[model samples]
Target chain A: MITVDATGLSCPEPVMLAKKAAKDNPADEIQVLVDNATARDNIVRMSRGVSRTASVQESGGVYTITLARP
Target chain B: MESVTKERVILIVCGIAFAVVAIALAAMGNPKNMAICIACFIRDTAGSMQLHTAAPVQYFRPEIVGIILGALLMALGTKEFKASAGSSPFTRFVLGFCVMVGCLVFLGCPLRMVLRMSAGDLNAWVALIGFAAGIFTGVMFLKGGFSLGKAAPTRTMTEGFVFPVVALVLFILSLVTTLFVASAEGPGSMHAPVIVSLIGGLVFGALAQRARLCFAGGLRDTFLIRDASGLITVGILFVGMLIYNLVTGGFNVGFAEQPIAHSEALWNILGMYVVGFGATLMGGCPLRQLVLAGQGSGDSAISIIGLLVGAAFAHNFGLASSAAGTTPNGQIACIACIIVLFAIALLNLRKQSA
Candidate 1:
């Protein structure tokens, strides 16, 4: 699993970083942590390319999206 | 805050925040429908800085400073303050400049376009149509692999703090020279009290920063993903504003005699087309640009500077339109901006596809 803490980053940046991470480690389940909904939406959109399902977990205002490939 | 889901709740909050802020600003003495206009405020700020000699719209707007401050404070507190730049800064600048020019030609940015429509300005309908069409065109380019490249993180965090610091300096300067530099006449002369305006700006800056509220982004999202969450926020704001206008007697239907607006329908449409296209290419609207700058994007800062410079150029070079009608120079400038933006889109988008 690869964790990318994108907490506090704005839109496109979070997605961009997550895309880079997903591309770099294609086999691993990438867990992206973000604090805002817009970033969450964008990250989910980007992750849809490589993964069919995204498991989401929330705690203390942070969103953790786990993208697992089929 | 934790209860905010990625769906409708965030959109509702953003909608309510924008609506409440717009109404409050209007009640406190901004122009009738234009409680907070990014492009207009930037133009006024430029005039106040003597970047342009447009006397009527010259005033150092506290809202402009407050938006950056609010965003910076939030970003820093959240530990998300990453200073970054170098994503085709010059191209972003040109896009920003073109966006401002288009807004000037139409006398409003995307935010103002919505606000104007909410206030029952029928002409805004034309502008809105033009905006959507322009976005449609940009989306076609995106389908062809349009991109501005990714921004790299800067070496120091201090780079991200620069814009907020500059805002603070500007606010202090406005305070000391209140009587001298502040506009004594024109639209710039009419303003909400400094404290109220600053507070209004702060609230909006914080909310928008948090929610990533952007008009252009909303439209873009609607086009790209069948998701209407952001567009719903905009719609809710329109409803909120409409209710407020109705309650406060601010609602007046028909286009003629609207304050600080023109009746030249074609120019208004073409002008906003330019704004919509430029903003699409830049990846955010004028308001979003301000928020991004606050969050430590140096590229956004350059774009903001471009907006200011573009405002200055609009007025100083007689490229800005007036309440009476569009100037020949303004029309010519709008055409030139469209051509330049198309050229940029073709050059960059083609390179990416290759």
Candidate 2:
């Protein structure tokens, strides 16, 4: 599992980090943490391009998105 | 200190500084309620270069120069500059141009919108409502996977030096004074002292760079994430401005006779609606764009070019509004920009195919 913590980073930063995670761990499940919805949504969209399905869990404004290869 | 606390403190400091700088610039002579307006200053700078022949609004503004240079220097000192580009260059340019049209229609960018509203301009209030509505709409687009794509990192640093170099040239020209055209009368002619304005811009630019303070993104995050971090800073700035205005007897709440503003409710609303939408599409406000350009983003530099050209275009084509009211040409341009914005938004959307 590749876990990417994107809390506190703004848009495009989080998205870029998520992209890097996917690139480096091509066949692994990626778990991403973000503090906002926009970054979460952007990461989820990026996951789709990599053929990964994303499941999100939220608590206290923090979102954990797990992207798994289908 | 915790990271969160540190970030919040930086934001608060930046906000307070902005309030102080805006007021101080005005006191030192940058037209009343006109301090720190990115669009207006760019327009004036364009006029000074004879990019447009507007007689009353021609002046080489040093604040613009100071801002870009300040951001560039801070980013460099902190080793945060990473020059890159290639994310929908033309689309970003159009969005930049369209946003400037919207700003001219309303006579202010987001920063000046706050300034005008704090000083009791009802037109700005109307524009605020439209800005919020537009942000909400941009949120809908985001939900549907709207993005400008990723910018690839460049190998060389030369691309990132563009805006900084421009700022340096402008700084020297501003000090030389006679090198550029100066406005004889009107809003363009009114200005604070060159050194004072540059200092204000430098302070504002450095703080804003550190905090990533953005007026439009604050609104965008408000609608998109239910996060108010960005808005909190703007709120702080507002309260600061409000307090200063009230204490100094500058506050006069009314629908008429506000300085540098018009009362056409619909255009004011639509104008900012376009601004909010375009800023969202491009990511960041006009001020943010300048900072990003200084940070070595060539894409943002292209956008800034569009802003300067758009400012010239608005004045040359009579598509900018005045204190009297919205011009017929300006009204048409606003509507056209809105249509073009919708088109860009729809065209750039990437649909996922499984």
Candidate 3:
């Protein structure tokens, strides 16, 4: 598993980081941490491009997005 | 801690600066409630380039070029420029085209939507609701499996620099060529001086670049996360323009007889719906596309090309609306665009989990 803490980063940046992580770690589940809904939503969207599923969990103002192939 | 404070200050400053400069430009004769409309300005630029012969709206807006150049300068200075492209370029083009159709039909982009509301054009409120509805719908798609594939890094940094170079070339071309013509009358003929427009564009571009300002993103965040960090700019922007209009005696409140706007309530709502929806699919607003181009995204450059082409098609085919009202063809086109966007959404989705 690869983890990325993308808290405080804005839209395209979070999306880009998620894309990079997904590309680098194919076959492994990639996890992303984001603070805002926009980042969480966008990262979820980007994950669909690289993987089959992205399950998200939110806790105390932070979202954890895990990307995995079906 | 210091960086966070600095970012907050910059955001507030940039937001205020954008509002003040836009209203000031409008007062100085750019257009009422249209100090900086990416779609209209781009359409005007197309006319200036003689891509379309719509006599009422033709002029090479320096602000458009200035935006790219300004962003380029910031990116270069900060060494944050990364040239990337090749993520569903044609779909982006189609989205850009449809967005222009919607904006021209509504007579404004997202920026002008806010400015018009600030200027007391009540029609903008309807468009706002429609925009919000469209965004809500698009967010539903995001929650589904819709995706536009990832943009890979370009082989060379020079590939990213192409957009800036294109901006420079356009600037030079505007200076030398009568190929680019100014309008003799109508919205096309009315404009602030070229130098002022350029300066305004540069300031807005630079500030928006640093602040990462996006009108659509603001609304999206508000709806999705219940966060208002982006929406804060929207509020500040409205407040700034409200003060500017009141002070300059430009505040006119009414639905009918607003300058350069149509009162066809349904079309106005539907037109902006297309803009809000298409912008969401493209991952940013029209202004955001220009900024991304400056930052060396070839995909954005392609999307900008799509915008220019869309503008040409809109004017040439009578798909754009006017002060009188939306044309029958324009109305049909707006509805068709919404359906097409839905189709795009459905077509791009991954299959459901079994």
**In TM-score terms, which candidate is top?**
1
DockQ metric for all predictions: 0.17, 0.08, 0.08
lDDT of 3 by residue, B1-354 (tens): 124366567778888999877976786779778888888899999999888889999999988988888877776775556677877889999999999999999999999999999889999988998898888777677656566765666778888888789788987888887668999999888888888999889888877777667888778756654445677667888999988888888789999989889988899999999999998888788998998898888888988998999899998999998998898889888999999899988887755332
Q: What is the per-residue lDDT of model 2 for residues B21-137, given as tens digits with 9 covering 90 to 100?
A: 998999899998898899999999999989999999898888887778778888787666767788888888998999999999999999999998998888899999988877677
lDDT leaderboard ranking: 2, 1, 3
Off by over 4 Å in 3: A1-70, B1-4, B351-354
- Interface Cα RMSD per model, in Å? 5.6, 8.4, 8.5
If both were scored by TM-score, which would come out higher, candidate 2 or candidate 3? 2
* lDDT tens readout by residue for model 1, B1-354: 233265468668878998998888878888777789999999999998889988899988899988888887777776656687877999999999999999999999999999999889988888998898888777777656567766667788788889889888888888986632657787888899999989888888877877778898788767764445568778988999999888888889998988788989998999999998888888889998998899888999999999999999999999898888899999999999999989988987644311
In candidate 2 the C-alpha lDDT for residue B245 amounts to: 91
Cα deviation of B128 in candidate 3 (Å)? Answer: 0.3
List, residue by residue over A13-56, the lDDT tens digit for candidate 2. Answer: 57656777887888899999886444665676566667788889
Candidate 1 clashes between residue pairs 3 or more apart in a chain or in different chains: none
Q: Which stretches of candidate 2 lie over 4 Å from their true place?
A: A2-70
Clashing residue pairs, candidate 2? none
- Kindly report the docking quality category of candidate 2: incorrect
Worst 10 residues of 3 chain A by lDDT: A8-17
Superposed Cα deviation of residue B47, candidate 3 (Å)? 0.7
Instruction: Looking at model 3 chain B, report the run of 10 residues with the lowest lDDT sum.
Output: B1-10
* RMSD (Å) per prediction: 4.2, 6.5, 6.8
Candidate 1's C-alpha runs over 4 A off are A1-40, A45-51, A55-66, B1-7, B178-180, B350-354
